[model samples]
Structure formats: structure tokens, C-alpha cells
Target: MFSKILIANRGEIACRVIRTARKLGVRTVAVYSDADAHALHVEMADEAVHIGPSPVGESYLRGDKIIAAALATGAEAIHPGYGFLSENPDFVDQVVAAGLTFIGPSATSIRAMGLKDAAKRLMEKAGVPVVPGYHGEAQEIVLLASKAREIGYPVLIKARAGGGGKGMRKVEHPDDFSEALSGARREAKAAFGDDRVLVEKYVDKPRHIEVQVFGDNFGNAVHLYERDCSAQRRHQKVIEEAPAPGMTPELRKAMTDAAVKAAKAISYSGAGTIEFIVDASQGLKPDRFWFMEMNTRLQVEHPVTEMVTGTDLVEWQLRVASGEKLPKTQAEITLSGHAFEARIYAEDAAKGFLPATGTLYHLKFPDTVPEGATMRVETGVRAGDAISPYYDPMIAKLVVHAKDRPLALQALVAALRQTEVAGSTVNAAFLAALAADPDFSKGDVDTGLIGRHQQALTEIAPPNADIVAAAALAASGAGALPPSNDPWSSLAGYQHFHPAARRTRLHYGEHDITAKVSVRPDGRFAVTLDEPYGSTNAHDLRAAPRLARWPGHVTVFSGAVGYTFAVPDPLARADESAASSGSLRAPMPGLVKLVRVTPGETVTKGQPLLILEAMKMEHTIAAPHDGVIAEIATEGAQVTDGTVLVRFAEDVHA
Candidate 1:
């Protein structure tokens, strides 16, 4: 094995690679940008180097800088951990030219699968079943539209380069094909610098199943079963599981054999994933699955495969890169228990899954169970770390394993419920709700599952009475009250002569909760809540509730969700009012990609007003109601969250 290696990435994947390298007694070097100077992965590495500025283009994407850092640190090899430079064939060639081992597939293998259209043609030559689509080289808009017409309506426009649901769109009709193509090309250009796209027939009830394949220089390859990545949002995988819930042995064997065949055909070395789109409207079948694309690096959900197969894919990568033979033959590998991995992201599900940035004040994962011994958390962040907008907003990947699919799923739900994350907007509640979803629990999953159940999953239910009480206890001085010799000072709301009540007010979104708390004569506390579900309650002053406070915010983990209440200062609340101004504010901090309205242009409700690109996704801000634009922000402007993007006439209501 190599003595030292450089992790050419950031976030959890970097940390993940570091862990496996350290176990092999290999020293690891971490590269970071300005935004991640104090990042968790940097602190965990044996040595760290500052590459460039915060923006990924200036740092992570700078292959020259990364190569220099690796050479300077005397790293024998470089591990491109999934995202930035993982699939860059040019980068792989550069690493090889620098005389450093690239801990992944060769440049030829990467190139074979770099462009979707070309990869499809390549797969077809290798006798691998590929989706029926327009894989031709023509990029003209009219040609693409005609191809969509030939395929049928509801065709998918996918970027020729890059993966992870970027630069992809689904058009439901011929009329929408032009607009979808334009959007797809623009996103493709912005994301992958390749505006070319391929039009493919959209599969009905598609289920994403990918086979994990590994190879060595000795021309040996094997498959590690498969992962069902059907539960998705916005075409991105959300929750993934190993040994697909309803996958039969025959289907699994067929898919794995095909995946291995693809790997051997390219003389693929190291770890790679062969993703297939399965037509599951009927059920899993050998002939119903078709090749989607090949990811030429370690996957984000590799842990699920590791849990079920008892294999460390990173370890396999290191061994193979070191010129070792395949760890195990196809017949030697065996599947064990089932596993699930839920990606926890720092996003607000209530606000359309908008990416959020904040310090993680309180972070906790579920305790490991005896039967779920393989349960683990893969993360590169801690409680004090900030989720920066310069990178992916993923918080962590929660993985669990059990004897069967049902047990594994149950454990996953329990773990998601027990997880606590504060000091930022998270999708914890949404994940918990999804875990308990009746349809999900039954394994009736597909790409459209989340979109179909979006309302229930994103609903922000009001806090119950217990949550209010917990917020009241934390907001009041009771929890932090110091011990005093004087009886009046010892108790909260104590009086010298007459009884008095201390009022505590807290804000949860738009609602205000006021609690009238007073110390009874016997030293017990009497609490009364105002408005809505008004009720009188009693509590002992000796116990403190489980709560976390960060400046103006207090969070209480009630039920499966953590409720955060904003503690507005009484002095500041006086100046606040519900100002019904005719303004449309930016929902999140992002770059104004396009401004569609002018000073006097009239727009109807739901009309395209502007577009803001943030967290690697484009959000189109629509007209709230019929209005005449009086002012508008400029295109290409960087705006903060809540910044007014458009101002309308006084007569218009937003």
C-alpha cells in the first residue's frame, strides 16, 4: 500500500477516504479552500494545505493546484473523492503525467463514460443494454426537438456531461420541449461547461438501481450486489438501500453480470458504479433494466454496499491502485444483512428544500443497537462547524444494518427520528416523516415518490403544547437561574410581599407564544399559555428540559422533530410590524441568474419574474399576484437572503 496519499476533495467524502487510508497506516493530506479553512476534514488529516479561494472553480476544480499540493506533500497517490475532479479524464491524465497514482479508473475508462451520448454508444458496442434515446452527435435545437418527437412526448433532456441530476429536465409535451431544452442547455453549460444534451424516452415508474463494481490491473472484476436509489427529489437520490426491497435473485444476478461485463470491457480498475434505470411499473426483470450512466469513482452511498457485502470499497480502491488483484471473486462474495443510507442535508424542506447555511450548534446521531452493529454515521462536520454555501449542503449520511429489509428500514427510521440537528434549517422532520410514510414503509418506491407525497412531507405542523412548555422553560431565566441564599432570588418570579407572574414570549415562525410562569407557595411552578390552546399547567423548578440555545434561538427536540423558537428581544419587538409592502424577496442567498421584469412591465400571477441560482440549483421566482413592476434587481447580481428582488406598484398585493 502507498505510504501517503492526498485526498483531492472536501466535505464528508474527504473524511471518508482519510479514515480508510489511516487504517492502512497511510498518511493523508487534505486540501481546502478559504471557506473551509477550519473544516472538519482539514482538522482530521495528517497534513493540510490551502489550495485557493472559497469558490470551487478557484480551488477544488483547479487540477493544477491540487496536483501541486499532492506533490509538495509527497503524496504517492491522489484520491479524487467523488465530486469535483473525480470523473475528469483530463485530470486523470494530468495526475498520471505528474507521476502520481490516481486512485480510481484510468483516463481511458473515464473517457469511455464521460459523455452520456458517447457512453451510450460505447455501452451498446460492449453488448450492454442501453436506454433507447437519441445518442447521436447532433446538437442543433431543431434536431433535438425532432428526436424528442420521434421518441415520444415526456422525453428527458439530460446533459451530455456530468451527473448528480444536474443539467437534466423532463418535458411532458411537445410544446414544452423547446423551453425544457433551453433550460437544460443553460444548466448544462453552467454546471459542466457542456451545453449539449440528449433526448431520451422517459420511463414509466422508473426505479434507479446501480451495481457497485470493482476491478484490478490484473483484469479481474466483481460486483457488490446493488443499491435501490428509487426515492428521489428533483431527480436526485434521497434514500438508498442495499439488496433492493423486492429484487429477486435472478434479476440481481442478471444486473450484476451485466455491470461486471461493462467493467471488464473497459479494463476498468478501482471502484466504479454502473447505474441502471429500471422500468418498475411491472416489476423487477432482467430485460426491464437499461444502462443509465457510469460513475467512474466511489459513490456517496457506498456505505450501504459496504454494510451488506462486508467490504470496504475504499480499501479495495487503495489495494487495486497499488497493483493488487481483485479482493474477491464473484462467487466468493456473499450478501448478508440489509442496509439503508439516508442523506441528511442542511436544507429547509418546508421552503421547497432550499439549501441553508448556519453553524450546527447541536448535532447528535442515534445510538448503535446490538443487532445493528454496523450502524454508522459518515460526516465531515461537527457541532460548531458551519455549512457553507460554497459546497454541497449535505450534513451527513446515516447508515444502518439489520437482519432483513424490514428490520433495517425500521432501524433507519428510528435513527432518523433520534437524530438532532440545531442552529440551522434541516430536513430532519421531513426525513422522519418520510421514514414513517406508509407507502415508503411498504417499499412501494420510485423516482416520483417524494414529488407525489411532497405536501405531507413538507408540511410544517405547528408545535404542540409540550413543545411550547419546553420553549417557555428554556426562554425563562429558570433554567439558567443561579443558586441564591435569598429565598426570593432562588425561585423564578419570586416576590417579597405579593405573588407575581413572569411572562416569557417566544416566536415560532409567524406565531407568538406567551407563557405566564410564576412560583407557587410550595416552590412548584405554575405555567399558563396564552391564546390558541390555552391551558394552565404545573411543573417542578428542579428539572431542566433538554434544550439548546444559540444567541437569539432556542431549540427543543419534541417528538421526531426539533422545534426552534426565535427569542425576539422585547425592545426589538416594539419596532416590528407586518408591513404588507409590494415586494418579492429572494428566498435564499444566491446569484441573480436572470431578471425577467422591467420597471413598468405587467406580469400575471405565477408568471416567470426572475431566476436565482443557489446551492447548485436554479429557483424561479414567480409573480405572487398580478402586478406592475416598479423596480427590479439586475441580472448577475449577488443577493443575500430576503433581499428584495422586485418592487411592485402600491396597488399590487404580494
Candidate 2:
């Protein structure tokens, strides 16, 4: 094995690579930008190198800087961990030119599968089952639309380049085709610099099952079963599981064999995934699976595969890169128990899953069930790290494995509920709810599952009276005894004849709950709702509420959800009328990518008015009912959160 390897990525994947390298007794080097100067990965590595500024173009995407840093630090190889430059063929070529090993597939293999259209053509020629779609070179709008029509209605327009659901649109009718095409093309161009798209028939109730395949330089390849990543939101996989729930012996064999064939077709080496879209409308049949795309790098959901197969994928990558033969032959590998992985992201599930940025005040996960494979918390951030907008907002990947699918799923739900995060918005509660969902629990899952049940998944209900009382008690320091030697200071709410109730108010997202506390003789306290926001009575405190209090904010994890309350100052009052100026503010900090309307331009309700690009996604700002744009922000301007992007001529309510 190589003595030293440089990880050419950031966040969890980089930290993940470092852990494996350390296990192999290999010294690892980490490269960071300005945003990740004090990142967890940097602290974990044997040596750290500062490449450039925070912007990816200046730092992570600069192949030259990365190569130079690797050479300067005497790293014998570079591990491009999944994102930034993982699939960039040019970067792989440059690393090889520098006389260092690239711990992944060859540049030729990457180029072969770089474009979706070209890859589909190659898969077809290789005798691999491929979805019937337009994989031609035509880029004309008219030609593409004609191809969509020929493919039939409800077609999917996808960017030929890039992944992560960007530059992809699903049109259910012919009338919406043109607008969907234009939007997909625009996003594709912005994301990948390639507006070329391929039209494909949209499969109904498709289950995303991807086989984990590995190859060595000796032309040996093997499969590690499969992972069902059907639970998704916005085309992104939210929950993934190994040994697909409804998979049969014949179907698994067929799919795994096809995956190995696909990998061998490109002479693939190292760790790669061959993703297949399975038509589950009827059931899992051998003929129902078709090639979707091949990710030419280690996948984010590889842990579940590792847990089920008892194989270390990163170790395989390193061994193959070191010119070692395949670890095990196809016949030698065996599948064991089922496993599941849930991606924990710092995003708000209610507000359209918008990526959130904040400092993590606390982070915790639950332990696995007894005699089960330990629940793993794969993350890159610590308690005090800042989640910046310069990169992906993923907080961690929670993986659980058990004897059966039901047990594994039960563990997943428990782990999600026990996982706690504060100082930022998260989808933890949503994840728990999804795991416990009747449809999901029965394994009737697909890419459209989240969308079909979006309201239930994203709906944020106010905290109950008990939860509010808990927050109030924690915030007021009523439950815990005072940290003082003097008895008088500790005598809070204690009266000579009777204990007096102390009132404290807390606000949770516009709803106010006032908690009244009565201290007991033994320092224990009873808190009741002085003003209940929800239609429920607040009972007396059973025990001290579990809480984490930061300045101005208190996060209390009650039941399945964690509720955050703002400890408002009793002396300060706000002017509601002054805060209601008619303006459309940027929901988050981002660059104004487009201004679709000019000042005084009349726009109907729900009309696209402008676009903001942030966290690698485009958010459209639409007109609020019938209104005329009185003021417009310039395109390409960098705006902070709540910066007015557009102002209306008259009051919106008026």
C-alpha cells in the first residue's frame, strides 16, 4: 500500500477517506479552502494544505493547485472523494501525468461514462439493457421536443452532464413540455456548462436500485449486491438500503450480472456504482430493470453495501490502485444481513428542503441494538463547526444494519429520533417520520414517494404545551438548582408560607407559550402552561427536560421532533406594521442569477419574476398575486438573506 495519499475533496467524504487510510496505516493528507480552514477533516489528517480561497473555482475545482499540493506534501496518490473533481477526467489525467497514482478508475473509463447520452449508447452497444430514450447528438429545441413526443407523454428531460438532480425535469403533459425544456436546459447550462439534454420515457413507480461493483487492473470484477435508493426528494436519495426489500434471487442475480458487465465494458477499476431504474409498478422482474447511469467513483451510500457484504470499499480502492489483484472473486463474495443508510442534511424539510447554514451547537446519535451491527454516524462536522454555503450542506450519514429488513428499518427510525442537532435547521424529524410511514415501512417506495406525501413530511406543527413548558423551564434555569454556595441565591420561587409561581414566556415560530413554574422543597419544580398556544393542557414536570440552550435560543428534543424556541426579552417590543413593508426579500444569501422582469412590469400571481442561485440549486422568486414590479435588484448581484430582491408598486394586501 502507498504510504501517503492526498484526499482531493472536503466534508464527510474527505473525512471518510482519512479514516480508512488511517486504518490501513497509510498517512493521509487533506486539502482545504478558506471556508474549511478549521474543518474536521483538516484536524483529522496527518498533514493539511491550504490550496486557495473558499470559492470552488479558486480552490477545490483548481486541479493545478490540488496536484501541486499533493506533490509538495509528498503524497504518492490522490483520492478524489466523490464530489468536486471525483468524476473530472482531466483532473485524473493530470494526476497520472504527475507520476502519482489516482485511487480510482482510469481517465478513459470516466470519459466513457461522463455524458449520459454517450454512456447510454455505449451500454446499448455492450448488450446491457438500457432505457429507450433519445441518446442522439441532436441539440435543437424542436428536435428534442419531437423526440419527447415520439417517446410518448410524461417524459423526463435530463442534462447529459452532471448529477444530483440538477438540470432534470419531468413533464407529465405535452403543454408543459416547452417550459420544462427551457428551464432544464438553463439549469443544465448553469450547472454543467452543457445545455444538451436527452429525452427519456418517465418510468412510473420506479425503484432506484444500484449495484456496488469493483474492478482491479487484472481485469477482475465482482459485485457487492445492491442498494435500493428509492426514497428520494427532489431527485436526491434520502434513504438507501441494501438487498432491496422486494428483490428476488433471480432478479438480484440478473441485476448484479448486468452491473458487472457494465463495469467491465468500460474496463473499470476501483470502486464504482452501476445504477439501474427498476419498474416496480408490477413487481421486481428480471426484465423490468434498465440502466440509468454509472457513478464512476465511490458512492455516498457505500456503507450500507459494506455492512451487508462485510467488505471495505475504500480498502478495495486503495488495494486496486496499488496494483493488487481483486480482493475476492465473484463466487467468493456473499451477502449477509440487511442494512440501511439515512443521509442527515442540514436542511429545512418544511420550506422546500432548503439547505441551511449555521454553527452546530450539539450533535448526537443513538447506539445500535444489542447483537446488531453498530449504527454508524459518518460525519465531517463537530459541535462547533460552521456549515457554510460554499459547499454541500450534508451533516452526516447514519447507517444501521440488522438480521432482517424490519429490524434494520426499526433501528433506522429509532436512530433518527435519537439523533439530535441544534444551531441549524435539519430534517431529522422528517426522516423519522418517513421511516415510520406505513408505505415506507411496507417497502412500497419510489422516487416519487416523498413528493406524493410532501405535506405530511414537511408540515411543521407547533410544539405542544408540555414541550413549551420544558423549553421555558430549561431557559429559565428553574429545574436545575442554582450554582451558588449561598442558600438565599438558591431559594428561587420559594416563599415562607407557599411557593409563588414564576411566569416566563417563550416564542416558537410566531406562536407564544407562557410557562409558570412552582419550585418544590427538594429543588424539583412543576411547570404549567400559563398561555397554551396549542389546544392541549400542560401537565406538571415529570423530570428535568432535555435541553441545550444557546444565546437567545433553546432547542428541546421532545418525542420525535426537536423544537427550537426563541427566548424573547420581556422588555423589548417590536413594531409589526414597520416590519411589514411590501418587498420580496431573498429567502437566503445567494447570487441573483436572473431578473425576469423590469421595473413597472406587471406580473400575474405565481409568475416567475427572478432567480437566486445558492448551494448549487436555483430558487425562483415568483410574483405574489397580481402586482407590478416597482423596483428590481440588478442581475449578478450578491445579496444577503432578507435583502429585498423586488419591491411591489402597491401593498400586497391592498
Candidate 3:
């Protein structure tokens, strides 16, 4: 094995690679941008180097800088952890040219599957099923529209160089095809610097099932079963699992076979994933699955495959890259149990799951593997670490393994509830609710499930009144009072020296909860409050001194009623006009990549006018109405959330 290697990435993936490298006694080097100088990945590596500024183009995407760092650190190999430069064929070639081993597929294989168009052609040649689409390299808009027409309505406009959902759109009718294509092309240009696109038939109720394939230079390859990545928001996968729900033995065998064939055809080496969009309308058949795109590196959801196959893929990557033969064959691999992985992101699910940034004040996960919960939290962040916008907002990955899917789902929900993450707008409660969802538990999930149940998923999860009262009483700086207290110190009503009941108001979103807390003669709290369900008694507090430190909690006391209420922070909000408008605005902090329209340009509703690169993905600022551009406030400039980019002028008509 190589003595030392450079990880050409940052964040959790970089740390993940470092851990594996350490186990092999390989010294590791980490490259970071200016913004990540103190990042966890940097601190974890044996040595660290500063590449460039925070912008990925100047740092992570700079192949020469990364290569120099590797060479300077005397790294014998380089591992391009997914995203950034992982699938960039040119970068792989440069790394190999630098006289160091690239710990992944050869530059040739990456190129074969680098572009969606070429990859589809290659898959077809290998006899692997591919989506029926027009991937021809034709740039004429009219011709592309004709191809969409040929493919049928409800066609998808996707960037030939697409991943993470950027530069993709689903058009339901011919009339919407032109606008969608234009938007997708512009986004593709801004994101990948390639305006070329492809038209594909949209499969309804599509479930994303991808097979993990590994190979060695000796032309040997094996499939590590499959993972279902259908649960997504905005086309970005949020949850993933292995041994797909409802996947029969026959279907698994067929999918695995197709994946192996694709790998063998490419003479693929190292780790790669062959993703398929399985059509559920006609049931999962060998013929019903179509190739989506190939991820030419270790996937973010690789943990699920690891749990089921009982193998560490990173170890295999290192072994193969070091001129070793395949460690195992297709027949040797086996699946043991079901697994689920939810990508817990530092995002506001209530605000359309928009990326959020904050310090992770207190992060704790259950230590014990519960009755039904087998928890594995892989993270590089700590309590004091900040979720910066210069990178992906992923806080941690919570994976669970159980004997069956039901057990896994049940365990996952309970585990999420037990997770306590403070100081950020994490989607823990939302993820917990999703696990408890009846449809999700029964395996009725899709790409649109979150969107459909968005309201319920984002309803701010607040502690019960009793819990709030307990916290409040503790925060009141009052340890359990003595049974008998002096009249001056006692907060109870007396005959002559009577103390009126104290009321503390706490805000929970829009409503204020007032807790009438008073000390009883027996040294316990009594709390009374009116909830939506009418007047109720809530006094769930244990007599403990530690409870007295809850600063913002509201302790309530009524006749034999006592409870603790948590105070919600009103400062945590996206500052913007509450009223809806037809103008386009920036949804987060990002650099404007492009502005497609000029003043007086006519735009239909949902037309993309500009693109923003933030949190490691491209987001388009869309037009909300069919009108001419009134003004443009931003063009290739940095902006924050709610910063208006463009407004539409009233439409002119005959």
C-alpha cells in the first residue's frame, strides 16, 4: 500500500478518507481553502496545505494546486472524494500525470462515463438498459424541441453534465418545453460550463436504485447490491437505503447483473456506482429499469452498501489503487441486513429546506445500539464548528441497520428523537416525523413525498407544556424550594404577606405562551395553561437542581398543575417581506454565476434568469410571471437571502 496519500476534498468525506488511510498506516495530507483553514478535516490529516481562496473554482477545482499540494506533501496517491473534482476526467488525468496514483477509475473510464450523453451511448453498447432519450450532440433549439416532441410530452430537460439536480427540469407539455430547455441550458452553462443538454422521457413514480460496483486493474469486478435513493427534495437525495423496499430476489439479481456488465465493459477499476431510475408503474422488471448516470467515485450513500455487504469500500479503493487484485468476487459478496441513511443537513425544512448556517452548539447521538436501532453517525463537525455556506450544509449522516425494513424505520425515528442537536436549524424533528409517517413506513415513498407533506414535516417541533414548565422552573434560578420558606423569599400567596402569581410569556413562533407558575407550600411547582385542546394541567418536572439552569424555559404552576415550557428563539428567521411577489430573489448567500436576461427581455413564468452557486450546488433564480424584465439588481455579484435580483414589468398586450 502507498505510504502516504492526499485527499483532494474537504468536509466529512475528507475526514472519512483520512480515517481509512490511517487504519492502513498511510500518512495523509489534506488540502483546504481559506475558509476551511480550521476545518475538522484539516485538523484530522497528518499534514495540511492551503490551496487557494474559498471559492471552489479558485481552490478545490484547481487541479494544479491540488497536485502541487500532493507532490509537496510526498503523497504517493490521491483520492478525489466525491463532488468538486471527483468525476472530473481532466483532473484525474492531471493527477496521474503528476506521477501519483489516482485512487479511483482510470482517466479513460471516467471519460467514458463522464458526460451523460457518452455514458448512455457506452451503456447501450454494453447491452445495459438505458433511458430512451435524444443524447445526440445537437445544439439547435428547434431540433432539440423536435427531439422532445419525439420523446413525447412530460420529457425531461437535463444537462448532459448534470448531478445534484442542477440543470434539470421536467416539462409536462410541448408549450413548456422551450422555456424549460432554455433554463436548463443556461444553468448547465453556469454550473458545468457546458450548454449541451439531452431530452428524456419522464418516468412517473420513478425510484432511484443504484448498484455499487468495484473493480481492479486485472479486469475483475463485483456488484455490492443496491441502494434506494428515491426520497429526495428538489432532486437532491435526502435519504438512502440498501436492499430496496419491495425489491424481490429476482429483481435484485437482474439489477446486480446489469451493473456488473456495465463495469466490465468499461474495464472499470476502483469504486463507481451505476444508478438506475426504476419504473414502478409496470413493476420492477429487468427491462423497466433505465440507466440514470454513473457516479465515478465513492458515493455519499456508500455507508448503506457497507452495512449490508459487510465490507469497507474505502479499504478496497486503497488496495486496488496500490496495484492489488480484486479482494473478492461477485459470488463472495452477500447482503446480511436492511439499512437506512438519512442525510441530516443543517437546513431549514420549514423554509423549503433552504440551506442554513449556524454553530452546532451541542451535538450528541445515542451511544447504545437500541433494541431496533443500530445508529452510526458519521460526521466531521463538532459543537463549536460553524456550518459555512462555502460548502455543503450537511451536518451529519445518521444511518441505522436492523433485521428488516420495519425495524429499521422504527429504530430510525426513535433514534432521531433521541438525537439532541442545539444551536442550529437542523431537520432532526422533520426526519423523525418522516420515519413515523405511515406511507414512508409502508414503503410508499417517492421524490415528491417531502413536497407533498411539506407542511406537516416543517411544523416547528416544540416540547410539550409540561416539559417547558420544567425547563422554565429550572431556568428561573430556583432549585426546589424548601418545604417551609421565610415570607420574604417564598413566592407563594400568604394571608397578610401574599405574593401574587408570576406569569412569564414565551414566544413559540407567532403565539405567546404565558405560564402561571407559583410555588406551592409543599415545595413543588403548579402550572396552568390553555392549549388548542382547551384548559389543561401540565406539570411534568422532576425535582432536580440542574433544572434551575434552563434560562429561556417557562415553568408553569396552577392548582396541582406544574410544567416546563421552552422558549423559541424569535431571531431565527429569514428576513424578507412576508407578502408574495412575482419578482425573483436570492434565497441564500451565494455568488451569482450568470444573468441570462437583460432589461426588457420577455420571460415566461419559471424561466431561469440567473444562477447562484452556494452550499456546493447550483440554484436558479426563476421568473415568476410572463413579463418583461423591469430591472436587474444583480449580475455576477455576491448576494444574501431575499436580495431581489430582478422584477418583472407589467406585460404589454394588444
TM-score of each: 0.96, 0.95, 0.85
lDDT of 2: 0.86
TM-score ranking, high to low: 1, 2, 3
Cα lDDT of all candidates, in order? Answer: 0.87, 0.86, 0.79
- Error in Å for residue 478 of model 3: 5.0
Model 3 off-target regions past 4 Å?
460-464, 467-505, 512-518, 526-587, 592-613, 616-632, 641-654
**Residue-level lDDT for 454 in candidate 2:** 91
Error of 3 at 224 (Å): 0.8
Candidate 1 off by > 4 Å: 370-373, 481-489, 536-545, 573-580, 651-654
Worst lDDT run of 10 residues, candidate 2, spans: 532-541
Report how far off residue 359 is in candidate 1 (Å). Answer: 1.4
On a 0 to 100 scale, what is the lDDT of residue 593 in model 1? 85
| Candidate number that wins on TM-score, 2 or 3 | 2
What is the RMSD of candidate 1?
2.3
Tell me the tens digit of each residue's lDDT in model 2 across 492-578.
655666666677778778677777766645545566665443322223445445678877789988645779999888788886654
Q: Residue 82 lDDT in model 3?
A: 89
Which structure among the candidates has the greatest TM-score? 1
